[model samples]
Target chain A: MSIEHRDDTGDRFGMWLFLYTEVILFSGLFILYAMALAKFPQQYAEASHKLNIYFGSINTIVLLTSSLTIALAVSAIQMGRVKHCLNLCWVTVALAILFLVNKYFEWSAEISHGIYPGSEQLAEMGEGVTSFFNLYYFTAGLHGLHVLIGASLIGVVAVLTAKGKVTSDRYTLLENSALYWHLVDLVWIFLFPLYYLIL
Target chain B: MTEHKHEPVPYRTFIQIWLALLVLTGVTIAVSRVNLGALNVWVALAVASVKSSLVIFYFMHLRQESRLFKICLLVMLVILAIFIGMTFIDVLYR
Candidate 1:
């Protein structure tokens, strides 16, 4: 019975431990961002102004909405509304897709203008500007990867919920997935300002 | 199913937090519009901190977690702060 006994709290704590390490991983990039900013403060300001604030702000709202839906999905399952929970989870996933699509268009625009890393255009712009674009692409690319992973995790949770493996009384998986989704949003909350807002 | 009994947050609360987050999103963009000189970066970071706190506590359910979880989070944050401070200090002295 001990082997079969489930400890939901322990499972959650395990998830939190994983989350802590994920935060640490991103902090490493943030440290690099600060170093690069210090090295090329002028290029940082100029490069930021060229970024499309419309895309960044719109994506921020989209991710925030997804966070709300995922949280509500957890609450829905806890209340035994399994269908509602599944629908909310799908809604959250849809928003994640929307966010990624927007990112695609944004990156395409930058690339079309010959703004990508290693391009002759960027090389002509000097080392400071080149470094700024490099950091922007690397940092935002990593964060976008997280959004993709988080969305896939939620999709798995949704499938489990539909099969009744995740339920009102036993929802550690759903909670863990929601926690990961919220963390994705949390990272973007900082990235928005750092990349687009503060010059 | 080990004695699972706890009050789940109401749907309204999540909605309210979502609204607040959207408003903060607007505020951050609006504030960034103004030229705050050297204070712009600090202001942006401060607002971002507040927004993340709301998500961490309410959305992530950190408020309902045990003391150990809270301690772990605090410790992680402290380490992050130390890392950030050391990086800036290194830049300043170099």
Candidate 2:
């Protein structure tokens, strides 16, 4: 074996670097949102009122719980509790599915009301509300994609753990997946307040 | 250089953080209902900052990361904040 070696800390550092990029990527969209809201504050608040806060709040809880489960899964693996780790990961995955299912219903309800980007019904609502819903769909859609990817990453990590590829002593994959999961939660933490809690 | 192992975070700590997050969520909801007018948005964002901090420091284990990691995170956040802050400044001034 070569004397040079890789360590988890370095791997985690790289992961954080990548996450910083993701943060910048989303910040670009948020800047757009801030400007749009600034230009049409009243219309933005009116548009925000249309969003179902109950749905948003429930989804928030679901995501927060998933974050906990995944964090626990990482802890379980660190303690060498493979089976427990597996179970927690699956639970996290299930919570992700629950969040998506809840989101689907939420989206369907809004869509049935003729609320989507570029829909004829949306265009009739005037420009500001249209922009609001359009941004809503875009941000929420991008975030949903992240949720899907994070769940799949965790799922793959769980399988690797089961096969002995990842272990108590070597679990960079698990830790990184947990970090990604938490990032998803991080984004939603902002989204819930900005979109759903309009005063 | 010698390698070091990470200490596994306890299950109870995770649970505690989870509870704290839920409570913060509830607090934001209650604050929003109080009709703080123009201040509502800032207040909402401030609470969100707190909530995200909890996730980063605890859930993502940034609290235990090396100083370099923390510095990098602060740098990234500061850069983003500058971008966001400048935009708000232009909006307010124009």
Per-residue C-alpha lDDT of model 1 across residues A93-187, encoded as one tens digit per residue: 99999999999999999999999988999988888878878888988999999999999999999999999999998898999999989989998
Cα lDDT tens digits, model 2, B1-94, are 5667778999999999999999999999999999888899899899899989999999998888889999999899899999899988987898
Clashing pairs in 2: none
Superposed by TM-score, candidate 1 places the C-alpha of residue B22 at a distance from the truth, in angstroms, of: 0.8
Query: Cα lDDT of all candidates, in order?
Result: 0.91, 0.92
lDDT by residue for model 2 (A1-199), tens: 7776778799999999999999898888888888988788888888999999999999999999999999999889989999999999999999999999999999999999999887999898888899889889999999999999999999999899889999998999999999999999999998888888776
Regions of model 1 farther than 4 Å from truth = A1-3, B1-4
User: Candidate 2's fnat?
Assistant: 0.91
> Model 2: what TM-score?
0.97
Extract clashing residue pairs from model 1.
Answer: none
lDDT of 2 at A112: 98
Q: Each candidate: fraction of true contacts kept?
A: 0.82, 0.91
